[model samples]
Target chain A: MSQPASNAKPIILTGDRPTGPLHLGHFVGSLRNRVSYQDDYNQFIMLADSQALTDNMDDTNKVHRNVVEVALDYMACGIDPAKSTILIQSQIPELAELTFYYLNLVTVARLERNPTVKQEIVLRGFERDIPAGFLTYPASQAADISAFKASIVPVGEDQIPMIEQTNEIVRKFNRLVGKEILVECKAVVPEVGRLPGIDGKAKMSKSLGNVINLGASADEIKAAVKMVYTDPLHLKVSDPGHLEGNVAFIYLDAFDTDKAGVQEMKDHYTRGGLGDSVVKKRLEAVLQDMLAPIRARREELAQDKGYIMQVLKEGTMRAREVAARTTDEVKAALGLSYF
Target chain B: MSQPASNAKPIILTGDRPTGPLHLGHFVGSLRNRVSYQDDYNQFIMLADSQALTDNMDDTNKVHRNVVEVALDYMACGIDPAKSTILIQSQIPELAELTFYYLNLVTVARLERNPTVKQEIVLRGFERDIPAGFLTYPASQAADISAFKASIVPVGEDQIPMIEQTNEIVRKFNRLVGKEILVECKAVVPEVGRLPGIDGKAKMSKSLGNVINLGASADEIKAAVKMVYTDPLHLKVSDPGHLEGNVAFIYLDAFDTDKAGVQEMKDHYTRGGLGDSVVKKRLEAVLQDMLAPIRARREELAQDKGYIMQVLKEGTMRAREVAARTTDEVKAALGLSYF
Candidate 1:
């Protein structure tokens, strides 16, 4: 439960906005990696409810209700709470305090120039009316990373800029204060990179209704697979199909365990032998096999909401202990430790 | 002391940054009002060491050392910790947490457009390199004001925009969250307004070296008065002098209790035959008489640094109770109070 040995494995920090239950995109992008990394590193999985409120401030009820949903998803996905700490962001006051201090090291111009922030502004259509929290969240994210002294941040390709921004603040603060109080973090990009939405969009998001939740039921999976974007030119079984931009085949590539079997299916579809329903049925079988266990685990975890909260509360206490040590170091470096 | 009665006077929130010992300008600007307001209203006096570090982040030892210096000045200037809470800014973690929440209510563009922040950026010559903390301090100020639920915030006229900005966030939060959880604050500008520096500049700033410390010794008082700006056109003490832009007369108008004597001096100086040295010596006498009791009190308080710190610790505990309650309400309104 304490920190690893003196020559411990490097630490990893990763989490999701508690806006909704995590989905297959999360599994392919970071969750599955977190499951694999639990034993190799000291992992801290955070339920970023505070960060979720930065944009969804009006929907606190959703954010509040989703903290447990997200935790359940993590547990069902094999993120063992005993091996990896599961924390609620708002419960740690030290992170907010550390964020306040980090803001001094960054500039509005720099925050505005952040690629992720800029893209989100355009995506959200908040051109001139961006929230201060939304705009400065890079600094807040930097706080989340550095407060834990997290050296490895598991993120997607698009989030490379955020990791760079975190390191910039770390360097700026250390240089200005003449103390290496904060550690720089590097992003560990997932090999799967991104999983397109069921509708063939670039990202699988809950808001778009294109996502298949990690704990989706068999019927729900079949319904989502039926709507999956496919080759419109393939009118009959004998017509040649285009595999490129086919959402069903793309998902099969990500989830199908048998690479040779997936290759044979792709070959048969391109050569006009496999029908869309036939390919979808194959994907349904693979997904149902993967999701059944998760659904069962999620159902069992859902029955004990108090236990889920207790896990988060206990993890928050442990997380706060580490964050407090870092905050004390930060204050000592800034000469703000009055006592 | 507890809050006032049913028809109680409005609460007032005012404070000074602990960057240095307060000077004559602080006395003329706000400290004097705080002393009298303690008897009529619920007043909360803060030693804003955290805000001081927004710009002076690298010089925290200076900030740390000055907290006690500023607190001692407050006590000597008649700000009773028993009647008016004298809390340190960094001690109340709730304020920082509240600031984080309030940041979401404000926008980056709106913060940049704040007139006070804009003017300060120009004045500080920080057009390109402005610190994020410096730009967002208005929000932090808003947190300071709202955390205490102060109905009245005593500030300079230039800070009117800051009050407007705070109220904007308050209204936005209440409207968006569909709850009236925050109180809007009114700026209580003093009639005396800004005090001119000894060199006749518009501000008596410690960095400008134009200030006479409130706890100045008699010798320091004479030295500062000797350098006070006066009418340059009155050669040989025989020429008529312009009353406008005379720093000495301005100080007398603010400090001299004998209005008739000050007017006679002004009339004599305007009509001619009154030497600058004579006027300076007379003003010196007035300032000395006023500062004697303050200097004695400051001397006594300076000897008991532990007592001053204990007072701050106790007052911080009291301030945290009020701030914590407000934070809880804010969270409940935002649906962030998970526990």
Candidate 2:
């Protein structure tokens, strides 16, 4: 049953908000790591639709439609439903309850001072109109992490403080209850994180219109490669190119399996005589080769939306059991366990 | 069946934070009204343990123990379980989910600006250490109200802002989803809302040692009556007594049903012929009469804790069904209706 029980391995929790379809930036930063993590760790990949709603409450249709698109992307990129549990956040309901309890442990001023939330508020230009849920999202995230007792969370360096906050709640809950009912999690910061956009922005955001969707067609990939940000100072084939901030080079660095070949091309381009077209062709070819199988698989999965939903339903069912056990324990700790 | 099913009447939502045994201040201000309201309204009385955790997170046992005590207070005061549903808020997990959703409709600044929340913050001396749950309790209250589609919320005047916040969430949720999914609730502000403390303070509070519990013994009632505040200038029976700010006179006005006798006593006291001891003795007798039956019922119910728990469990089961239906509708409206 259940492939000889994968619970022997340590648990890792990771996923993206289902506000939009994922992109190459997501793949290079987190999804690729998660696909590998499923083998070594008991992985739970969440489709954070509720967290998506904290910001996209006005356009719920966008969040609803993207759940399937994001699921397709996950399956296409080889996130095996048999090995990894892929669940929707809203479906559990226990997470919300856990979040409610955790909110009591965190001070409002401390939440406002969370660097990630503070930066996001400014980035979204929320000013004084910050939705109460958006401000309390870190508490919600703490629930997501501790509900599974996940020991490992794969996130970027910018999200280290979230792990700290989760542990703070974990410690506070246990100390207040005089029992260790919840576990603290550690952030696993990847060395190769964050792929720049085709426009060379620090973040590949959908609103910026610079991101290439993971399910992008071959033509779309080719077009994006053609417009990839290259060194403007390198006007002629004889001129030496600067590799820093070059989107094509960055994508090649992230996708190319032949490290020696990429290093040779970089040297040739830096020393002059490597035409931009040649590098663009190589980058386009590499991207097409990497994404062709994923694109075809995504197309095939898209045809059977019912199967994807079934997988999520089963996964959410499994996830709910785990979260419910934790919630019961939390309630018991809080002395709220009524028969 | 079940007394012709009280679900036919308009629903009323009301409750107390079960942080302590309910007291005389609770009875005169709201419990008496609720006992009468149960026949005319499909009442849902919530034991707000979760809300109690907002400020009393460090002492959750207080919330837990008081749930049964408070339930005893209600049952003793003739809140028929067959007419009014008695539920523990934490038992209905859907309320937490609904609260998470409703929080998105309110802004951090908007919740911070609520006059009731603002005043309470200062009174509690929370300053910069307000718990996130405390800051967002209005959203939780909105969930408690709208989950039952409650149109009437019996509350004091100070709590009107909470009802306003609830309606704002209901309107915003319906307008956002383009459907009338949740009903707006109205605050039924009681004219005789507050009962002064034994020390003649504006409010009776347990911490101030000025409240008489609904389950107080006859001797306890007499002792509390003996300490009731009176006019300091009335040194002798010949000295004129001021009835204003005199807690015993106020309590007589609140509990003594014989209005003509109370009026006669007031006139005699104003005419400088009645002694303070006479009023205190009269208050003691009135309190003993009012509390005797209730105290007996509370004592009998306390002997059978399991039965009280079973009642709450059954009521919570019924409450869960009502809340679940509304949660589904809310999810459907938000386009989060994933199977």
Q: Give fnat for candidates 1, 2 and onward, in order.
A: 0.68, 0.82
- lDDT (Cα, tens digit) per residue for candidate 1, span B148-169: 9898998999999999999998
Docking quality band of candidate 1, CAPRI definitions:
medium
Which 10 consecutive residues of model 1 chain B have the lowest summed lDDT?
Answer: B1-10
Cα lDDT tens digits for candidate 2, A1-339: 212245578889998898888899889888888888888888999999999999999899999999889999999999999999999999999999999989999999999989999888999999999999999999999999999989899998889988899999999998899888888888999879888878889878788889888899989998888889999999999999999999889988999999999999999999999988999999999999999999999999999988999999999999889999999989988888889
Residue pairs with backbone overlap in model 2: none
Score candidate 2 by DockQ: 0.83
- Angstrom error of the Cα, residue B171, model 2: value is 0.8
Residue-pair clashes per prediction, in order, are 0, 0
Model 1 bad stretches (over 4 Å): A1-5, B1-9
Worst lDDT 10-window in candidate 1 chain A: A1-10
User: lDDT of all predictions, in order shown?
Assistant: 0.89, 0.92
